[model samples]
Target: MSQSLDIAVIGATGTVGETLVQILEERDFPVANLHLLASSESAGQSVPFRGKNVRVREVDEFDFAKVQLAFFAAGPAVTLSFAPRATAAGCAVIDLSGALPVPQVVPEANPGILSGLGKPVQVGSPSASATALAVALAPLKGLLEIRQVSLTACLAMSSQGREAVSELARQTAELLNMRPLEPRVFDRQVAFNLLAQVGKPDAQGHVPLEKRLVNELRELLEAPLLKISVTCVQAPVFFGDSYSVSLQAAADVDLQAVNEALEAAAGIELVDADDYPTAVGDAVGQDVVYVGRVRHGVDDPAQLNLWLTTDNVRKGAALNAVQLAELLIKDPL
Candidate 1:
């Protein structure tokens, strides 16, 4: 049997944080004690875990030295403020907020990066879109050297957090009732409409989400020279993320071999050509990336296309954080 350790989950009331707590129990991670910490506004709330209620304590009041591992699912500001403190207190941290200036880890793609780390170091989890993209491209890395990658990611409002989810629900209802649309969580209407940009545009015109996907993919693939371009769109749905990827390989590739490679890849479920996965219909609550609609360019056999989807909250954020923690525990690096 695995030995139990003390664990603390920051931002216990947020969407990803809540999911992390649930996954810890679902995956049967050995735990001697579980601590839930949140901001003062959310503190005192009870979160269910292992058939009991665990009250959340204010993060400012919690002592990081008490826990062996800390999972930060809070936003960037919160993570930045507390992660360093936790690390200094000798607590290993797996940050899902993408704010930590640490090694960004996707366990399935680069578990080795964590093996050499010192104890109590902070590890950043890649963005949801980046995580899905990295997992999809991992199998194709050596099979056919990729020259460039272009992708369009359709993200749901849930990726923004629980408030965004609630805003989407509110806007959707108002629209159905023929009321004026109120856009708060998002810059524009997200009810039965799609936003071309997911975040504020940069000087070069690329949104923050798009920039993150490109940068993180290159990092996770360990291919600094690899060229990647991405467009992030906010879909009207409430959960899951979908991607349409176009890969330009350096050499001719066989369709059969590509399909076989994806089939054998970890944390991926390749669907049949005749069937495809939708975020709402197939990806929600699932733990693996669902891939289908694979086809090679007719004019250029070196080019390939694919459609991928996964639960943004599950495999994208919460599960990946938990898996990273598991890896750190097993290796204690």
Candidate 2:
């Protein structure tokens, strides 16, 4: 922990990348030199670090050998293209984008996975929804024999990036002023309407996000054969992703134990039944997942239902990757 290491943040100009920089400063990661990298278009932009605005350089031109650790917080294309070069240069990589088929890690759920990784370590952070779900459910895993999980993830526009967030705002303003609305970032009007699917469905009628949830959640929970049914709905919100989850347990449900488990778990804030949580009210700009509305299904003691929310950009993507780095540096990176 005393040794300082050079680190690089890919896609530093983007939302998740910027948040990663902020969290690294906030958590005081043992960093030596901090390199901020972006695409050609985003290069020359500056991201505020500890006490200075660090000018971001183009990722393609930067040498990966300069840093001991690198965080790939950009899109899949960026991670897919540059991560191998980083690993080839002996730099440890923690990717937030789903490009790499490496291990999907949530520190709270599977911190032990890092120790078993191979040399020139490579790991992936789960999607925002899966990260929140793993934080909520991992604690209860030992107490309940979960058979399957059903979830409807209400994603905010920010999950799609800054443009989606702006489009939501513009569409809302035009609607309020009774002006003609033209959808640009989204295929249709997302303001005051729920999008049934996030992207085009494959032959099996499941979108990519849904597949990501299933695969990543299973990995995080260490349940390779676990059954999961998820529907990623685009909610007309600006930030935070919410989930309506139902877990089918093998035995009769225990409400008190479930509540206590959530209450004592790390990276989770359990709300009382008196009032439920909303994305804007509870989760936005926060670091932990907010869980409420915990109860058993009507006339079905084996079914447990809950509501969860978290900041998709911060806690879900950036912070999760940063946390993996913290654990990875525990020994040597």
Candidate 3:
């Protein structure tokens, strides 16, 4: 007998939300009913779900009493206002915001951690860390205790949000048409530029998103003391994320064995130089993590350097949320 579950996607019109819908349809999740919720401005609009149209509802009017699972992607504000109510109503909330203060999930990188949560696990981590976690951890699984990691991410405009995606498209059209460029949704022109930050500034100038990555990565890896240094930059690319990870681990780690482990791991792909080696765009729409340029650290042979990429929207955010939902369905609470 097939199980029936009512699935609700909050923020269904946003970038991650839209991508989640596409993935859910592509993967054919066992959704008995699909509910799309967004702000009032987007409410009443229709979105495709399982080949049929599902009308978007206003978040304020959403009823969670009969919802078996709710996928919250709107933001922390909405999640805080509604998540508890949904949970109290017997709905398991899978939040995409950092608000719930729980699992910072990268499903391919870490699965089963969301299990036994008794309710939803909020996903934190920036797009950078999500990609890094998926690729970097593949090689070291169970073999090396990663003590410290330093990562610099080359991110896409999509990380900023859907409005940024639109801004990029509008600016690109203007550029190709030889029109003057104006910027919004980004600090400056993003069509032919790179920005070093995302989200608001902290006292040290680190964005909230970047700080979340450090803490979330530590929690996800179960290495609470794991030291992480990160610098996130937004590139002109449309999708995907790329990173260079330098890790300090135990003594005399075998690069060959690490590479072998990554090559054989599920949901990961090893890219060779002859394959035209690396690019952020290469990760778009791909479900697997891509690893390249694996080498020993210059300072210490125990340390390792790796280049990683994944579809920022796929494995990084949307697909990861969907993967968690899938896991829940396959194995109930």
Candidate 4:
């Protein structure tokens, strides 16, 4: 807060990394200098920061001196290796990767959770589950206590990381070109197909990542007793994470008020026309979470159904990380 900030974007060539740069530019965040970091393969590549070209340096060569903040858009492996060094060198790290296991944060739901860090060495939720959960609960928090929530996520390829995004594009191209497919990033071909699993299978055959999503949302919402069930499926879309939520509230809630609440929610847009359910393509490059389809169970007034969408790489990953950083900068601990 005393001087212009020196910021480094680790993994500057990935999907979230590119969006992090764009968000910083679009929001005009104050920065004294910018550094782009990636693996050795992209060491000499250059990415535009503000108006100048910042060459992508290898993570091993990142100089943390004078850097006020470092956005870790890489992965857990990189964060485990570099984040501590950056913090030790006096740089605050805002990681987009799901490296920070504790203190899970969804800005709208848990802004106060990141309090008292003069230099927050790490921040960010791994996937869109927390982001989508926050948007869906915004209306219910005021109307009725969210006793329980059941959600199933249609995760986009981009959420898996840059490699998966590339796989989606490459596989799609091969399909269009009528070429034989050999999947690399994903366990199977993503084009013209869906994977009912994400991350890896656990004892019950449910993906661990999806279970973590439910756990992360519970922690962020501070509803320890909140009943949450999730089934994550990998969709072919390149961006956007969608969730179908069925919630049971404390009492009979007003549907109109819920709709209006969603409409007025900060950092969220309600798409409520007859044909206005937000689409995956619609969320690409957008910042806000989109919510729609409000319905009440006929026999149970406390039960509700809704759909939510968000740009996984933006709102779900980069933009949300930036939003947390902005909040920290405004009311520094």
Candidate 5:
């Protein structure tokens, strides 16, 4: 018989948090008791799980000892404050915020990293874009020596959380009525527009999101010095993430080999040449990373170009967390 475990989901009222709850139920994780937690503002609210309304309790007042595992979908502040507390209480923590001080993980790409980690593993989930990028590139890692990667990520407002989604919706409605648009969640009008910057730029002029993509890709792929550059843009849509990736290999690449590698990759759906995936039209609510538009570079057979899309909230965050949880369940640290 499967052992039932006690689980707590922090930030249960937010976008990724709510999605995590749905995925847990959908995957039928063996849960003895599920605790839904959120900030004081979100407390008293109820989220549906296993056909029941689980009332969200304030994280500040919750008891971490009650749960064996805790999934953090909250922002950095909440994670930094509570993750340690939960860990000290002997609860394994999987942080989806991408900000915690723990080993960043993508289960499909590197489940071996979890082995021999000692008891009560605490790990951080990769950023949504990093999740998609790593999954697409992992299959090729064994086939070709990837020297460099250049990517452009088109992210939706949902990446910023539910508030950003609401802001985009309000701006769209106001724009349709010809009313003045106020940019609240974003620095500029995000409705019917694109912003080149996703987060604040660093000393090297790389935004946090771009820097994170580079760092996480390296760790997930186990390529310490891989050259990677990414341009992140906030799209006008509300969900899903679309990416244009260019990979430069160390040796001459074969087109057929690349296609076969991608097609055989786990959690990747290769699209037909005549068809392509759109974030809103095709990738929403999907669990797999959709890859299409595979082609060789104009002059370099050693280089490849591919278009990829994924439901970032699911495969990128919640699903990845759940998969890691399942890994822990199968091979307890």
Candidate 6:
């Protein structure tokens, strides 16, 4: 018989949280009991799992001690309000909201750090762009001496929330039907058009998502001062995220070695050179990051470029958080 522990999932009604529940069931995680929680407004909803539907309860009314582990998948404010209670009750926490001022981790990039954490573990998951980059780059750290990484990330509408996702669909349908479009979630029209930026920009003209990528990617790669330039654009996509990455390695880069490294790496899928991958076709609903278009700079052998894609909500958020739980349970939860 396998050892099992009680688990609680915060924000269980959201897309990522629902996906988290689905993954837990699909992976056959040893869950003795499952606790679904959300805000009062979202409570009373039911999520299907393990051949039955689990009714959600309000987070404010639920006791953290009832579960050995809890996943924080809500907004930063929600995490801030309830995480302390869970931790105080000796519940291990995996925060996907990036609220806590902790080191962001990716299972493929920094699994070793899991064993060294203090008791009542509190871990933070990296952003989507960071997670994909870490999975693709961590394998090549030993192969190439990287000095700088420049990336342009095309993000899906689901990153903004369900409203944005619904708005994109509505706008697209209206345009197809030759009807006037009205943008609700976003200030401007987003259907069939790319948005220049993702989140609000600071005084330095850098958005939160871009800054998060630069910082989280460095942490995941264990390079505190690695130079990273990231630009996040809101694509007309609904589910997956795409990245065009260029790494400036010191001296000449061995293209064959890079290809082989990515091929052997866990959580990455190497696409054939003749065919490229897209967010919708290859990455959505997939757990691994797809890597293709592997080549060196047109004239500069020191520069390496690659294209990567992954399911933002699945692999990037829910599965990554769940993978951390899988590791934690091995050491006794």
Q: Top lDDT: which candidate number?
A: 2
- How much does candidate 2 score in TM-score? 0.99
> lDDT score, residue 57, model 6?
94
TM-score of each: 0.97, 0.99, 0.91, 0.92, 0.97, 0.98
Q: Where does model 1 exceed 4 Å of error?
A: none
Tell me the tens digit of each residue's lDDT in model 1 across 1-333.
Answer: 347889999999998999999999999998889999998999999999999999999999889989888999888898999988999899989988878878888988887899767777778899999898888888888798999998989998888888888998999889999999868978788888888887779899998788877888899999987888888988888999999999999888788998999999999999999999999899999899999999988798999999999999999999998888787777553
What digit string (tens of lDDT, one per residue) describes model 4 on residues 1-333? 444687888989888898889899999887778888998987898888778887888989777885878888887898889988888887777766677654667677778777844554466655666776775685467677887888888888888877888889999999999999999987788888998887768888778777778777877777877888888889998778888889988898788888888877787877855745554556667878877777887789999888888888888888887887787676542
lDDT of candidates 1 onward, in order: 0.89, 0.94, 0.76, 0.79, 0.89, 0.92
Positional deviation of residue 267's Cα in model 5 after best superposition, in angstroms: 0.5
133-175 per-residue lDDT for model 6 (tens digits): 9999999999988999999999999888788899999999999
Candidate 1 lDDT at 280 equals 86
Candidate 3 positional error at 179, Å = 4.2
Query: For model 1, how many clashes?
Result: 0
Pairs that collide, model 6: none
**Deviation (Å) of 161 in candidate 6:** 2.0
Q: Worst 10-residue stretch by lDDT in candidate 5?
A: 110-119
User: What does candidate 1 score in Cα RMSD to the true structure?
Assistant: 1.3
lDDT of 4 at 315: 85
Give the TM-score comparing model 3 with the true structure, all chains together: 0.91
C-alpha positional error of residue 332 in candidate 3 after TM-score superposition, expressed in Å: 3.4
How many clashes would you count in candidate 4? 0
lDDT of residue 50 for candidate 3 = 74
The count of backbone overlaps in candidate 3 is: 0
